[model samples]
Target: MLNIADTLHRWCREERPFALATVVKVRGSAPLPVGTSVAVDEDGNAVGSISGGCVEGAVYELCRQVLDDRGAPQRARFGYSDDDAFAVGLTCGGELDVLVQRVDPGTRPYLATALADVVEGRPAAVAQVVEGPEELLGGMLCVDAAGGIRHGPLTGVLRREVGAQAWSLLRAGRTARAEVGGDAETCPERLSVLVHVHASRPRMLIFGAVDFAAALSQAGRFLGYQVTVCDARPVFATAARFPHADEIVVDWPHRYLEQAEVDTRTAVCVLTHDAKFDIPLLRLALGLPVGYVGAMGSRRTHDERLRLLSEAGVPEGQLARLRSPIGLDLGARTPEETAISITAEIVSRTNRATGLPLSALAGPIHAGTSS
Candidate 1:
């Protein structure tokens, strides 16, 4: 898991043996996603979480069993059923497929490199045999963004196939299980491998140094975003104003955005509330393939800004991408509440959610990866 990479890497460096339980698959309204993990040592110490404290006790015991047996990795299923809803069942009414395996650096050296990549925010993926023969259990293959195989034991066709699958998952920024070696004419025994992708944190560029930007910076950091606060005025863009921002730039917003590396996962928040900065920055941001672009202003200010941009020759299609008077309606008045509303809007947009109350909904509380 990305959250526990540092702790796991430390355990590996200390040569301490431990058991790692990963949520390989989930059904219905699961608490965590597919790549969530929990690590437990022999002394009953634990790191990370698999179900946000819903099914952790059961998974922890399962980890203990794997550590005690020192055998092939085991798969455990936890769910909520009417017959056993109160017996180690998830309150979220979801099913989780967990794979527990021993992490011994002496045997699985590739884990160290994978953990390092995760800790250092390098794009990488780890492919592990989740279901196969005893001899193949715990077998791992790691691939980085540069098409480099850091460590792997598989060779020939199988190695090539797994490497390609790992790369595909890395590009998709998802974790999934794939079936391998299922050609009945040649090899009848099929193997299931789980690929865990560790992509770099998404970027959140806040083009303002106002009080709202400081609160938004902290919120962005909490959501695992590499936040950057930029403004032309160096005196107002001091690090002390927004300590949570990953980067503070004393340059024009549009100029900084022109040189920034933004992807489909990146988000741009224009809190400048000024036409001079907003027009130029919104022009560049709306043309890019970023995930979100929102500007903060009153309705009157937004209308005037739109008219200015229209006069500047920005197309109507590009103008539609700008979310002026940004953030959802939550009756927010304070800076912290406003930050929460803005971040909530970003999360809902990224997840394709309706930003509706869960009690009013009927389907899964947590959106699926495909959603």
Candidate 2:
């Protein structure tokens, strides 16, 4: 489990065996999404959780059973029981398919290597066979960002196909299932693989050295973003100014962004109200494939910035991507509050949320499992 990677890695290094119960699939109303896991050691010590509280006891007992017997990997399903209220199930009315498996260096040598990558902050994904032949039940393969297969089986065409799928899911930072039928030449079995991805932290590039940028850096870090604060002024872009930023660049905003490694998950925030910095930086950011691009300014400033960008030959579609007069309609005043507003907008956009109050909407609070 990437969430408790440090603890798992520690156990692996100590040669302490543990049984892991991971939620491989969810049907509806689940408290946690796929890849949520709970690991139990031989001494009855546990780490992590599969359900918030609903089906934890059942899952823990399953883990203990696996540990006690040193048994083969097994899958258990849990859901609400209408007839029996006291049944061992999820009262939340969701269905979870959990895979319980034992882990140790001797049995799964690849696990230690995969855990090392996760703990060291590298992008990695563990593809485990959730449904397949008995022999391949717990087989796992590790795929890194570079498309290298660090460990596990499925050779030849099967390996290439699974690796490509794992890489795609890893890039999207999604833990999902992939099905593969019998490849006549490579293999002859229908399998369901659960790809548990541990993608690197997304980037949050704050293009300014103002107080707002400082506050935003902290908020971005809190949201698991690799925050970088950049400005042309050396004094303002120092580490002392942006203590929470993972990187502080003293280069021109546009220049630094031009060489920055931006992906679809990256968020670019132009906090510099100055046209000299904002215009050039936005011109480059809007055209890139970054997730969110917002600028801090007033209504008049936003209009002026748009006109300037149009004059600079920015396409209308690209200009439409800009979120000027940034942040939601929250009447935030202080820098800290404004930072919350900005990060909230970034999260809302990323998650495709409506940014509305939950009470105002009518439906399941947790709709889809993407986020």
Candidate 3:
């Protein structure tokens, strides 16, 4: 899987054979969503995880069976029951549908390419036929951001249809299952494919090389974001100050944001707390369709900033998108705590969460719109 891209690349370079077990479908309170995978080598070495540790042992055995049999990929389902709490079921009372397939250096050459693209931060997607004819089981199709099929097995109408579906999922940064072929009423044996989007790391643009920026950069990296720290002052925006940041740009915040590539997954954190930078930069950020746009400041500063933004012709709706005071009400007093608060707010916003404690929630802790 893309999560273990580095390890997968190493295995490919070493010509090592491995079995990949992917969670293609999940139900109930599953810990991981579809597309999460774990790889086990012939030597019993493992990388990644499909479950949080509940069904891993059984999945590992399934991986070994795939390598030993050298046959068509197999699917296994694991779930929790009232009587099977201590068995191979998830402690969280969830269910998982796992697909185990052996991958060899000679047979799956596209895997190496996919792993490389993931490591290099390129957008890609892996489309696998999880349910189909025995011979087609585990068959793979790979596509990149440019609508190019790096490798695949389908052809003609089927290929085009599947590629279009994969491209759509890739752009949305979502993993999902798609059905192809004739209508159920007219024909049977419809193909079921899982499109696993390997999107590049989401961007986190932190405008201001302050202490909070340094901590936020580290937190962003930990959360798998490509963090950029920007400031107009060259002395403040140095690599030494924000080592975890992917880039340190010494430029005006508004100018840089105008030229930066931001998507629905991107998060912008305005930590400069200066009117000159915050006013102009926020005007642009609020108008863009980014995932999050938060500015750090006190209550008084927030009111002043809003007044200036309103006077600058920013629409009321766009101004409402700004999360002034930046983070959640965690009563954070230190840079590290503030960074955690900010990242937590970003996560909550992106996931459409209520920012409530798990204990207070009645449903699954990781609940979200299923894909």
Candidate 4:
């Protein structure tokens, strides 16, 4: 996918006319988060997506019209309601307000900066929410590399402190809430700054460097992971076999993870099932904050490994974190199929989604809150 903001900035800088479709507000089971944007140039070439695929066609038609009309920012709202309202709304039963605007002077500069940060992988995307006066709730902001704030509207001590807090959320690539009401009071609409953080992609530290490791490394890259395969056996750890991996290190697994470090953003998959290789590495991996830790093995093999881990004093809490049977219960029989199931589980776990279908579930399709 193209950088939606970058595409807009190019059109603006080239003195060419273009239109941008941005998600301004969302209520009731929205698919894409608010502030999602895409640019359609005068020639009808478009970049980025707004909904899963629902609203883009309509949003594009609106863009073609806006290219000729020059004025202040224009806003459009889209929603789904069983109760008839507008003729146009999402059929998925969610409400979203889309702000489509000409790439005019008003937003050209601000959008340019925002897209610059995103294209360069600068870690966050934030926007200002210009809602009316005293009802002039502050706005949103995001974090940067040095843990600094990018967008800000709140003022004084609270502003300064919350900016720092907002950066923390951005670093983790999550949306968060921060109180912007000057006093210790909390307001429902107190600058509900939706901090959009771009957590660095998870690092795949593949141990063993075997045929399975090679396949898993490729699979990891396909899934947008920064794959790194490492093994102390230099013969097996050659870069030729794993061209897709970002780093192929001939290093010990335990020492490599210890030094390179793994956070909640990292994913460690132990492909080397040999006890001498997998055990010590498992000991180190279990202690880290990685989101997904999967080790390839049969149920019988995993049980043995678990017993050994318990004997090694690896603590029940930490031991419980490992996905021993590795992937989900997909009954995968091949390396390719197994890799898919494993990665699917990892993605589902990262987004806090169960391995269940939306149709089977009862209420709304959100990870946490219900309306």
Clashes per candidate (backbone, < 3 Å): 0, 0, 0, 2
Candidate 4: stretches off by over 4 Å:
1-3, 12-20, 24-31, 40-47, 57-77, 81-86, 99-111, 130-142, 150-162, 175-179, 182-189, 365-371
CA RMSD for every model? 3.0, 2.1, 2.7, 4.0
lDDT for position 39 in model 3: 94
The regions of model 2 sitting more than 4 angstroms off are: 82-85, 182-187
Task: Write one digit per residue (lDDT tens) for candidate 1, span 40-126.
Answer: 988889999988898889899999999999888898888897886578878888888888988887776777888888888799898
lDDT of each: 0.87, 0.87, 0.88, 0.70
Candidate 4 — number of clashing residue pairs? 2
TM-score for all models, in order of appearance: 0.87, 0.93, 0.89, 0.82
| lDDT per residue as tens, model 3, 1-371 | 67688898899878899999988877778877888899999999999988888888899999999999988799999988797557788888777888999888667787678777877878888888888777777888888878787666676667777888889889888788988766544224678899988887799999999999999999999999999999999989999999999999999999999999999999999999999999999999999989999999999999999999999999999988999899999999999999999999999999899998888889766667243
Model 4, residue 24: distance off in Å is 4.7
**Which residue pairs come into collision in candidate 1?**
none
Displacement of residue 355 (Cα, Å) in model 4 is 0.7
Candidate achieving the largest TM-score: 2
Superposed by TM-score, candidate 2 places the C-alpha of residue 315 at a distance from the truth, in angstroms, of 1.6
Worst lDDT run of 10 residues, candidate 2, spans 362-371
Q: List the residue pairs that clash in candidate 3.
A: none
